[model samples]
Target chain A: MENRNQITAKQLGVFVLSAQVGLGVVGLPSDLVKEVGHDGWISILSAGILSTVITVIVIALLRRYSNQSIFEINRHLYGKIPGQIINFLLILYLGFLMVIGFRYFTEFIKLFTLKATPELFLALLIIAPTAYLSWYGLKPVARFSGIIFVILFFFLLLNLLTLKKIRVSFLMPVGAADLAALGQSIIPALLAFVGLELTVFLYPYITDKRNVLKWVIIANLCTSAFITIIFLVTMGYFGENLLKMQVAPLFNLARYYRAPYFGRVDLFFILLWFPLLESTFRSYFFTTYDCMRRYFSFKDQKLAYGLYAALTILLSRLPKDFTQATQLGKVVNLAGIAVFGFLSLCYLYSFFNKRGVKAPCGKS
Target chain B: MSTGMVSCVTIVVSTVTLIASLSLPPWGLGLPARILKFTALFFAALFGILGLIVTASVTFAHLVTLESLGQPYFQPLIPFKPGKYDRKKRP
Candidate 1:
């Protein structure tokens, strides 16, 4: 058994929750409103429950065996070569997530603050620290990561100032909504909770896996609830006017936001964005590095950062513009499902062959 | 270097847009101009010093404000109206 690192369970929960929720503040409300109209919050709530159940299944699956990393379990249940192959496919999916997160952060800043700044520079600014941080390890990040949430909480409180903007009239009784249309929004909403499954990767590093279930489920629940509040507030302030706007609704909300003394929310978002964005980038960064190392023996941290940087830079360059991003974003979302859902099912199938454990996903 | 790059880009883009707004004249751009004007009023409350310049350059047809443009830091920009001696002229 390789000694990974010790991080307290509380840190794990905070890390996972922040990773999943960071700066989801932007497109979450925009996409949700496009489908469920005013009741978009309901769709987000449902997606959160779905994510909790899926996260619990992943955490439970990882916990069932004693002291083994997910990679070790992959080999345990499914033999050597096949397990390694599945691991390769899964890591590639996480690599794609790195690209999406980086591009979204860069594109967002471009549209709002620096209209003329090239994205590649922004991408480098983020990736350099992310590679350095994840390469450094979790606890160093664990301390400052709490500060990002604090800053995000302060930003979330800004919405409290904007609460007066919410139209009780707009919150009008279920005026009209088609179930099919609202259901269409669920898949993308699920992507907002995407990093919850990192429990499988972090499981090895978690010092006390006992009662891991409580924190895992609670983290997903908090992430979901926070994001739903964000969507409701943002779309409520602007309504369907946001549905047509191409990027970050929160940024637009901030742009128009004014206080009696302090002023626009944009300044706060600019000052604090790097940390929140860093949490998301590091989650994907470490998850991909862990997965890649599982299949291919890479001992050096420098090499890990080098591989991740090259891969993300190449992937970020794939889309030429925003139009292309939409077309590819769907593909990335589907890839997310494969990594989070389908691959978990593969692990479930292998576990099923022995001891006849009750299938947690339920019979299809 | 990164901070400077980000600021330089922001100033450049805002300047270009400011020039475009000047050319369009306040009432000419229709709905968009009015919306842009309304947005500047909010920025004015928040950013303070730059807010008036932003609003004047974009939304208002007249270059008007009682705020000082002759403070040591304010005099460099060519677009500003220098401060007057009358206290009544100050905001």
Candidate 2:
């Protein structure tokens, strides 16, 4: 049966876009510059291509089952014990993503805008609304993604003012990073695109299911294009060596950018970031809440959302400092890689079983 | 005020404003969404300004008990009233 709250393909694309952007895009240029110079954009593009291929494999695996969520497919393909264990692992990953994403936002705000603000207070200021919004369910969240996509355009506009500072010579040594360096940057770049796994859960709730792959790939390309522009601009403005020292190259673009009768563009960009950050928070929490609901067979969704939000906020306090928070982020991305590996294995088994049986596939 | 006092005030004021903002839409009252949007924005701005002043408050445990029109306003932001407000009565 089709879900009444199903989102359209376009909205799904926006959801994927919002999920991937998060706070990672702000620091992406600096992080990549340390390794690949201007060729960092290439690393991001390669990661996008990799994500698309993995997404296709995930979609193929999903198509083998009849509209069942990944959590359900886990139980059906494996025994109940292993299935629950896998589901719990996926839940843990989503929980970790939520906590880390929150930490990143709080840190960014504290560093740039509110240097003396308490971490717990800032975390609540962001998480409270995000959890409240998640309570409204996927349809509202999908609708909110439309707003987030529009807000992202404001970042591009603010970024354009940095043109005055750009130097063509900075990008003259384009391939300076070499193939090996570019290859090394791919895994770190993949961390920025970790949320693509959202599709495995979102597919069943998407309208126009036939075009899911097309929309998702478009979303990936759009995100890559956006991040690439930021990378290009940052490299041209600061050069690779200077860019490496900056924490958030994209936000820094706004620090120097000036327009007619206006300044402090960085603060403006940060203000607009609430919706974008909240959208990412909601998407991860959706997976977390959905997993909890399925695991416990909980009928009261409000209670489930509350528990998820509380646990997420609790976990956010565990990281000792910014370095530990980032290390935890790397660990979570590694766990995400394992989850994708598991998905690929599921697909391989399905494909071989289909060939062997010669029976009509995708039935429950 | 001291740092701790500022945070305490920030959380208390923002919490009250958040409840008001969450509840003002009056989905039960059948108010137009535009008005609800404006009202919510007003409260949200108030909440944001107050929260910005403190920026370092504690957790959000108080929101759990907040309600709107006799309904839990924090989570499950929408109530499950089937066939009451919609053509299709699926909760």
Candidate 3:
């Protein structure tokens, strides 16, 4: 097969939005309220700012390798053997992420819907569709991602409407509610924004790679702000104490209805997330596939499927109990991947001058 | 893909997958899959089997169960306390 590298700008934006929505909307908010009290939104905003800065830094590095994906850039900058090693490290990092992402969705389902079922089932339930989409390729997956992005934002809007129910008194005295706890909370909050790295490997698919920075920074900002507000509204409507007490506060907040037409918030949140989950997993599979293909020369997509299945199954099992899983999951926060050496690679690749064909500063 | 080609692939793939999905125990499919996924992305065959297992398990477990299940059934809920809503209200 010819080297297949083609992605539209719309697809890139959708990919960005999918990465943002997948993990953050469901879990990022709880810690914010738990740690900072009413000012949890502030931490979210801080985390968002940090995410954007990091995202921009990484994008600039990727742009420096304008014509190359993260895998190709590494291969160029480091050469075959060492580059393959870097690629393996990044793939492992993302593979771990793919498992965790699968676990996150499964855990959410188990917590809210199938309390009696084995999580392996729920984990598998999710990965099935994800597998099909990954096999289908990224463009189709991303188009669906764009559609879900709109719906996710709408859920946020609906969630905000519920905010009128919150007592202003519940939101007062916002500053430094618990400085130490809030400081610690930022780590996890930052982790929720983990998918930004997806953009790093996606440069090759992107049609108008030149416009990547503009959409990328914008999507990151808007997505962060939207989620930050959603977190705040969920907290404001339910109060920090109550919000932190629940699994998905935003869902419960949307469910807290008195209108004659609807009875629950979770059903809507669940329906909306169905597609978001697909796109999220698709990107994870695609990026990992690209990295592995370039590094290990693992060309068989079936093998990729098998690896993903095992990772999720094992990850889903590790939480020997639900509490342990959530704790371990929380421990694997936004900055977690960076800690695993992605950040080091970014600096090294950029510093070593693996600049793309027409890089940002023309300084490859 | 042509309907004929698609149908042929689906039947061929599903037959093998049906066997794999049924034969493998929970968490048992890990080792082989790990080596495969470690090197590249997924093949439709393995993904199909996983899809079947997840769907069958979820539907069968629920249809057979006396009560609804929640997230990662074996894991403890956060805070390790059952919520007030875990039980339906008397009202």
Candidate 4:
């Protein structure tokens, strides 16, 4: 019988896409517009290219030890004590990512749909489903992500309705953004692509070892293309000045159009988008849960799930308002980048050491 | 009709389901499997309660945005499907 934990290469692609596309879709357009004018698409494209390179590096490193996750690889390369420390740090980082993404999702819901719902309750709504889905492990998460990926495609198609109202001239004088501006935009753009590094943890669970790289790269490209199209549409519809003022441009794009039956498409869109949002949240939640279980060698799985759920709910509510939440996000983004760099250094260390490279027979 | 009643009903239903489901199992479920079932049921209850709370708290403008099976849940009311509800034209 096939291993229950394993997912197909295509599922892997969808998994990464689902993870990368979440909170970024809501706010990325306005942020990019603020930083790069109409050339935000260009900045997103460049960030995509850069993220693809990092993904390739990550895949290359994982390829060396096909059977091991980064956790086990860390243990093997750095020895037990140091490896556990790095693993603990990785767990903390994953937990922080979960907290930040959870807060962002809840905050968006409060701002647009449920204005009166406490953030703590909103966080619980997401956390409950996330904890449930993650308890089964990667296979269920992967399957759910595949379903979300299809929904995401339909969401993207809905954007095309804005074409009638959009002024292509608004994106006129393309490439008007100077090189320095474009350069500055890449940091935020790169931040949008932060979830791609999830490939490191997902590498081993993927069943098709040979094509894992291709799938991950394809996933990143899909995300890049998805975000770029969203930016282009939002920029065309709202222009530079108006786009910068809107917090979540994607929702505005939905609101700009009305279907025959539904009056507020944005509200409908948010309802549809909730599962996609939850799918992304669950991905990070599962990763944190898995990492914690591995690090502590927890025998009681229920306790682990409860602890993680409690920890994320408590920590996610720390930011008082949008400004503070944005600041917290910035810290997480920087920490994500630093974690990626550290992973690369670990890859390099293993490459030169040769003797440290050993493929453990079982899963981490 | 109060929001509190809806929340109470949801919480009670969810709690009952969660408690009852724990006993009706295969009994041979390993620790992980048992946890999986518990997690699913626990969240189901929590979501039911929280979702009802949100449903009660949000305005009708926001509530009508929800749909079931691709059809507007509050159809012919919020959307005011006059054609669908035109009693004057009924033969």
List, for all models, the DockQ compared with the true complex.
0.01, 0.06, 0.05, 0.04
The sequence of per-residue lDDT tens digits that candidate 1 reaches over residues A1-364 is 2332456676678778778876465677777777677777778888888887787778767766665666666766777898777667767777777777777766765666556556776566556556655555555444335545566677678778789988755655663677887677778788778777677777767788886778778888888778877777776788765554636776666777886655656765654565677677777777787677666777785776697687787788788887676666677777766767764685577556543233345553
The candidate that achieves the highest lDDT relative to the unseen native structure: 4
Q: How far out, in Å, is residue B48 in model 4?
A: 11
Complex DockQ, candidate 3:
0.05
TM-score of chain B of each: 0.27, 0.23, 0.26, 0.27
Whole-model lDDT, candidate 2?
0.72
Using TM-score as the measure, name the better of candidate 1 and candidate 3: 1
Candidate 2 residue spans exceeding 4 A from truth: A1-4, A353-364, B1-91
lDDT of 1 by residue, B18-60 (tens): 8877887657565676676677768666544234333433222
Question: Top DockQ: which candidate number?
Answer: 2
Q: Order of candidates by DockQ, top first?
A: 2, 3, 4, 1
Which interface RMSD values do the candidates have, in the order shown?
19.4, 7.8, 14.3, 11.9
- What lDDT score goes with residue A29 in model 3? 73
- Please estimate how well model 1 matches the true structure, expressed as its whole-model Cα lDDT: 0.66
Estimated TM-score for each candidate: 0.74, 0.79, 0.72, 0.78
lDDT scores for all predictions? 0.66, 0.72, 0.63, 0.76
Q: Sort the candidates on TM-score, descending order.
A: 2, 4, 1, 3
DockQ of 4: 0.04
Give the TM-score of chain A, superposed on the true chain A, for all candidates in the order listed: 0.89, 0.93, 0.86, 0.94
Instruction: Order the candidates by lDDT, highest first.
Output: 4, 2, 1, 3
Candidate 2 on A79-112: residue-level lDDT in tens? 6898789888888788788788888777877777
